[model samples]
Target: MKVKYWTCHSDGCAANVHIDKNDHFIKSHGQHHHIPEPEQIELRNLKGKVKERVITETSSITKIYEEELARSNLSSTALTLAFTAAEG
Candidate 1:
């Protein structure tokens, strides 16, 4: 393919930038093509990872927690009282 594929070097840009093999710029397409600050991209990625991990782990444990809760004989009031006593 003689087409040179290019993308916005910006972290936040979802734009498609293209060029020809002849070193001629083809076109850059997007409503927003501004570059994101370095720290912002780092933080944004970190937050996304954390959120993904949390959702994954939570989904894995949710069924286990629900099963245990269902098997328990203790009422909500009794559980609360026990928890309060344990805290003291």
Candidate 2:
């Protein structure tokens, strides 16, 4: 079956990728693409496996973003007010 892989955009997840068959792409938690070689099936599989590892290392950045957002406590309304006051 064809398989696809996706890496997490976040920088801290050690195994933040997910991979699966092109038909079952989302099920794998990775990305989706068609596998293209009967002879190179092993190599394609290895690529997908590596993507899983990279994703895990990259996911931690999400937590950092969330934590910082929580600490800032700057809501949209507050930001708008601050900007408007500055303009005045």
Candidate 3:
């Protein structure tokens, strides 16, 4: 079975997970020292959805993006960051 390793994004954090070919959790290591950033996680997921729609659908990218953002309840900070990332 194929294995994939997922590592923490935070600097100096050791938290990680191992997954099998089917994306089932195999094991985990370490722990996060800080509180979870749910908004950031949500924003990341929203971006992924928008990207998938952009790739598979024939709709205008602006329309796809507007629809996704409209459905999501991301914080002002997250929305600002998303637009900034898209602009840059």
Candidate 1 residues 20-59, lDDT tens each? 8887888777755564445444434444554555576766
> For candidate 2, what is the lDDT?
0.45
Candidate 1 vs candidate 3: which has greater lDDT?
3
User: Model 2: which ten-residue window has the lowest total lDDT?
Assistant: 35-44
Best lDDT among the predictions, by candidate number: 3
lDDT agreement of model 1 with the native: 0.55
Which tens-of-lDDT digit does each residue in 21-80 have in candidate 2? 644534434333443333234334434454555576665644543443344445565444
Clashing pairs in 1: none
Clashes of each: 0, 21, 0
Candidate 1: regions farther than 4 A off: 33-88
| lDDT per model vs. reference | 0.55, 0.45, 0.89
Better of 1 and 2 by TM-score: 1
Q: State which candidate, 2 or 3, has the greater lDDT.
A: 3
Residue 87 accuracy (lDDT) in model 1: 56
